[model samples]
Target chain A: MATTSIARPQAGVRPEGGGLLHRLFGRQPAGYLFLLPWLVGFLGLTLGPALASLYLSFTDYNLLESPNWVGAANYVRIATADPRFVAAMRVTLLYVVLSVPLKLVFALLVAMAFNRGLKGLPLYRAIFYLPSLLGSSVAIAVLWRQLFAGDGLVNMALWQLFGIEGPSWISNPRYSLYTLVILSVWQFGSPMIIFLAGLRQIPVDMYEAANLDGASKMRQFFKITLPLLTPVIFFNAVIQTIDAFKAFTPAFIISDGQGGPVNSTLFYTLYLYQEGFGFFRMGYASALAWILVVIIGAFTAFSFLSARYWVHYDE
Target chain B: MTSSAAAIPAIHQPAERRALWRSILIHALLIGASILMLYPLLWMLSGSVRPQDEIFGSSSLLPSSISFDGFVRGWSGLQVSFGKFFLNSLIIAVLATIGNVVGCSITAFAFARLDFRGRNFWFALMLGTLMLPYHVTLIPQYILFLQIGWVNTFLPLIVPKYLATDAFFIFLMVQFFRGIPRELDEAAMMDGCSPWRIYWKIMLPLSLPVLATAAIFSFIWTWDDFFGPLIYLNDINTYTIQLGLRSFVDSTGQSDWSGLFAMSTLSLIPVFLFFLFFQRLLIEGIATTGLKR
Candidate 1:
């Protein structure tokens, strides 16, 4: 799908070398007309702000004053002096590394269960997906905060089920971030749906062939299904990694926007937001934003580069 | 099915029974897991009806004596009525949905069907924008809107949709439009149909599934969006439902837990209804986007 989409424009490239001006101003003016909204948005909203942010990263703008040139000072300060920045980065990296893999594993397991052609599979899928639909909302985050409180339902369950007293999950510094990670893992429905589709796409004949060789079900999965499903896994990993980095709402709402209890839940985006909006350190925040872009870009590039070894595409 | 049953020997009954047992065990596990998964939501629903003091006091999902007090107090809200917030969210969500559906479809039509110079470049640029973190654009976009006096208005939240700033929807529509047979456009063109007519009559009608998908997503995302309203709209009068809920938590130990849960349950109704009605399209959209190959 990726290769075919990239190859499409090449097919449209004219063989004959038309004049540069002619090629520049094609006959299809209506195409440009159709593209008017996106073009204006691209320049005015996206590209314009993007360029402004790049410049803002090097300045000391506080939104109250004019931006002053301070070449790399914000970046240096963040790298050298900012404890909260480091904490936020550490928190976010831990979140991505922990939540994403756990979520993906759970998603794959559920998808495999659903792929067994369960009756009322649609109903189950919807039931499982309900959390994801509500997961990012302020309401859910608020609910989550209460649910993990000392006297909340989770602790109540812990006491009733095992006679063990549970601590306040949201208040304790050690457990606060894990609560958010659990929230993330609960919303694994999107990836589960994606995995289900990928599982469906695997040829049934391959499984049958494995069965004819007297391979066990686990062996069939390991030898046949896993290899075929690697591409989807890689795709989900890259997307989820980026998503986990940008996570904000849960942490923000759960910690009441302070990243409370020693900054355990201070996601990178939340910290960036605090610097930019809450503290009015717009330039520092812009620098943080650029760093995030670089980090996400690096992860994406790394996944794509490593994909060649593991992600299989059938010819 | 009959042939398979006939081919199996009558002595294979124990094996079939064992398969049945396995199936029963799987179902039991799934049912148990589903209950655990749905418990929080159910507990929230029950808590909404429970008395204020009884909410956290008892962990039981069933309220011994249910009351409408939470709903009444929550609806009345702290300073402003929840109705106003709901209206604010609805207006923004509806406008954003319409803007995304119309603008994204048109942009996608141009990219997928119309031939023009720099088309590929623009398309690639649009795709690249998908990878750009919203944080990267956050400060500058806020500053831009602030300078333009759109800070305290819905314009910051809604206008971008009209300008097709959501490249994800545009990309989805593009993929959908590409799947549509080009011969339809050719056939229409041969019959004296203009590009506008082709778009309005053929593409728009044929692309209903994707358009509906985009519209539903736009509505849900906008309705649930807290950060945009948090940054843009400061006035409580103009606050969305999310902001209203946030305001309920004073963060100094005086949160209206019962009222918050009531309002939260109310807030989820539209989304729940939408999901129930459009489950197939929603699932298909997620599946097709991820597993296009």
Candidate 2:
């Protein structure tokens, strides 16, 4: 939503010309009245807690006693000694790097396919979008664990068709993160819909011109479609990267909430959960949370900064 | 039948054939992809109904003999019945959805139509919250709720909604509200209607589509939420469907695969039904805001 100026009574003037209270409070008591709920929420739920967490990140509080300030001790320990923190960072980075691009590419390809005036477009879209709707649900996460088990459907097909055995993917450290990656890719529908919307906004005359110039379909896609679609791509990239970093349920469910099998699927959020709730190391978890915020902030900032070079905008 | 006419038809035949072939190929590709995408879900459905011995025995979708034994066992297999879990989920989802719609609409009206001191500052702050990861505040909020003796209650899950903590819905509504011509509010004001009357009588009624979008999404999100319940709701009696499902796995420990599958299938039914009924609104909502889920 754009933040455009709205009609307002002039400062120091009241429409009804009331007492001193009207001028002191400005001419829009009704505005603050309507904004009361959100103001309360922002202060109470978001801003207050956020600042509290930042303070707690520098202290040691296990919920049993008052927080004792450690002054960067927690951050030092994480950077130097904590193996699980390192593992979590490695796993989460791998997941973000592997998942976001693959998901976006798949979304773009499917969006392109659907943009060709395909028959049954709605049906195809609904089918594709179903997974994303159900993706974060524990039910789907449960189903995912089964699908990658040793005697699961994947291995069953492998043995029956190709005469090869497959690993119990979720239990294998080598393949566990890959299963989560595939799961992330499977829910590519949301980005696809956004991409489709972006695709529709591209003028058809551009395609007609390319067609008349003897451009091949592949050339037209790389030359016209990709450039025009960069804004949507950037949007999807940032959103999906942030989402992937925060991914929890699949790793939690599939790992039996342990982030096990050598901690391969120990996502940063999972590790934070383990520290915060599981172990009651509230201070450590607060530190972890702030680190995640910085990481995500850096990513978003990087995307926005890099966008100027590659993300084409008409305006 | 001149030679030129014969050549024209001949030239058109191969092109038409090629177009037909391309369409067939595209349809085949799409159909293949769709089936692959749907196969796991279909498998889960079939697995729930099939005989226990046949679940891991074959990868085929068809079950030679089907039974509802899984549903029968899974429904009451837990300490608390699945029905109770469903009711708990329904209550939380409904309450959360109502809170989000009502709270977000009024807040949006203020941001969209009203003018106040520090309006720009607050509005920018509100947008900034959209980018802040929930984890940053989650621990402190958990601690706050714990201090208030709301650790295991649905209040921890649903109360923030009433306070308009979900800024996405407010943003969505603000966008939608901006599209409704300010003339409607101006016309109502000319009748000496207060801003409250304008918001109540004019803005909201015109915002049904966006409201429905917010409602459907909030309901689905609340229903699908696992972390909230996992963190705050510890009692089995108070557990939502998501917690129930996860506990079903933990308690069953691979002994009741079919039961797990059965309840999993049951848990997805509400979300699936919502999608089937409101697919267009849901898709358009995502497209408009680029919101994931």
Candidate 3:
């Protein structure tokens, strides 16, 4: 369908019967005209800045002074000497490793449950999706801090229900990052919705066949549903992983924009913000940014490569 | 079901009873989970109305005695009123939505309908930009804006939308516009209508669903954005609600819990309202493309 729609224009181009130069520049000026805003933005905002940042990454530019070229010094320092860089990487990696799988698991479970021909499915789905809508807001981040405070609701519930004392989870470095992990998991609604859509696409006759063959629900799920859902699972996994890497607001707000509680919540983006805007280390921040780009690019490449081994396609 | 049940009453009775029990169990579990998910927001809402002394150490969603004191205090808690922050956020979000809808749809129209040289190449490039992270471009864009003296103004936040920098919307609109049949454009062209007129009169009307989806998302994202406004709009008078809420955290410092809750609840109202009014569209958008808020 996509290919046909994209190729339809080719026939239109041939029918115009213009010379190559005329076809390129004269025949359909309206196409370029309509695309003007996006073209300008792509060049100025995205491509230009990307190249400029790559150049800045090799320099020692501070905001007040003109850039002084330093030829990979920033990358070398990051590779060797920067302790906070290591810490930030550790925090971000742990976050990505922990949050993505947990969120996906929760999302898959809830989606499967919802997919079971339940009554009031729309109401249930909306209730589940509310968090994903509101979770990234500053209000939610603030509410999270209060929820995990020593005297806050979680501790209060712990004491009242179980007679156990709960520490301030947000302020305890030992547990601070875990709070953020839980927060990430709490917003599993978006992935759950995607999974629901994917599950809906699976043919029901397959399930009926399994049931007639004396297979239990568990066996059918494992043998049929899991195999068919791999593509959606892979999609959710990659998108969630990239998003987890770029997570900034909750950590920044929760840690008071310092990534504190002994740097436990020092998300990579938060650290980048600190370096760029806090210390005015524009060059160092650009280096950090490029490293992030490399890490994300590498991860995306790895995922696409590995997807061939696991991702199931009907074709 | 009744005819089969009558033929095998003994077997059917147990199965029916078991199914009922299972249904009950599932509903019970779902309702329990729903409560767990909504508890925190309800908590904040309740906290906002409670008196100051009663705000902490209470997990109940009921206020001891409802009071407007928190709202009054929070509205004027900082140097600039929360109303100003809200107005700032609204201006930015509304302008961004208009810019995105107008800018992206036209770009998508060209890509999906027009026959142009290098169309496929440019389309591929546009899709590639969808995956690129904003961090790499952050510093240099900031430098560009700073050099042009766009810093400390809303220009940095709003101008990019008019230039259609958000490739996600463009990609989304492209997918939608492609689904629009070419026969309609051909028919319109036979009547001597220009492409622009056809887009304005036919495509835009037919594509309201996608446009609304893009507009709603654009508004919500711009309203919820913190980093852009945080870096660009430093002045207190120019802060968005996210920045205002952050500064409220900084200035209050446990001095006013109820006030903080009040403002936080207020900050989420616009987004919550959007969700309520556009629930179906939002869900369909995410289901189709996995759009993030």
Ranking by lDDT: 2, 3, 1
What is the iRMSD of the candidate numbered 3?
Answer: 4.7
Q: Check candidate 2 and list the clashing pairs.
A: none
DockQ of each: 0.49, 0.59, 0.57
Model 2 global lDDT (CA atoms, 0 to 1): 0.91
- Tell me which residue pairs clash in candidate 3: none
- Predicted candidate 2 versus true structure: per-residue lDDT over B10-116, tens digit per residue: 88999899989999998999999999999999999999998888888589999889999999999999988999999999999999999999999999999998766
Q: Pick the candidate with the highest lDDT.
A: 2
DockQ class, candidate 1: acceptable
Better of 1 and 2 by lDDT: 2
The parts of candidate 3 lying over 4 Å away from their true place are A1-23, B1-7
Candidate 1: the clashing residue pairs are none
Tens digit of lDDT per residue, candidate 1, span A1-315? 122223222233232334563366453556888999999999999999889999999999999999999999999999999999999989999999999999999999989989887887887899888888878889899889889999889999889889989999999999999999999998888899999999999999989898889999999999988999998899888888888998988898888899988999999989998999999999999999999999999988988898888889873
Candidate 1 lDDT, B161-208, residue by residue in tens: 989999998999999899999889766665556678889999999988
- Name the best candidate (by DockQ): 2
Misplaced by over 4 Å in model 2 are: A1-18, B1-7
Tell me the TM-score of model 2: 0.96
Per-residue accuracy of model 3 over B1-293 as CA lDDT, tens digit each: 66675579787789899999999998999999999999989999999999999977688899879998999999999999999999999999999889989999999998888777788899999999988999999999999999999988889999899988898998888888889898887766655566787779989999999999999999989999998998999999999999999999999987798999999999999999988999999999999998854
Candidate 1 lDDT score at position B37: 83
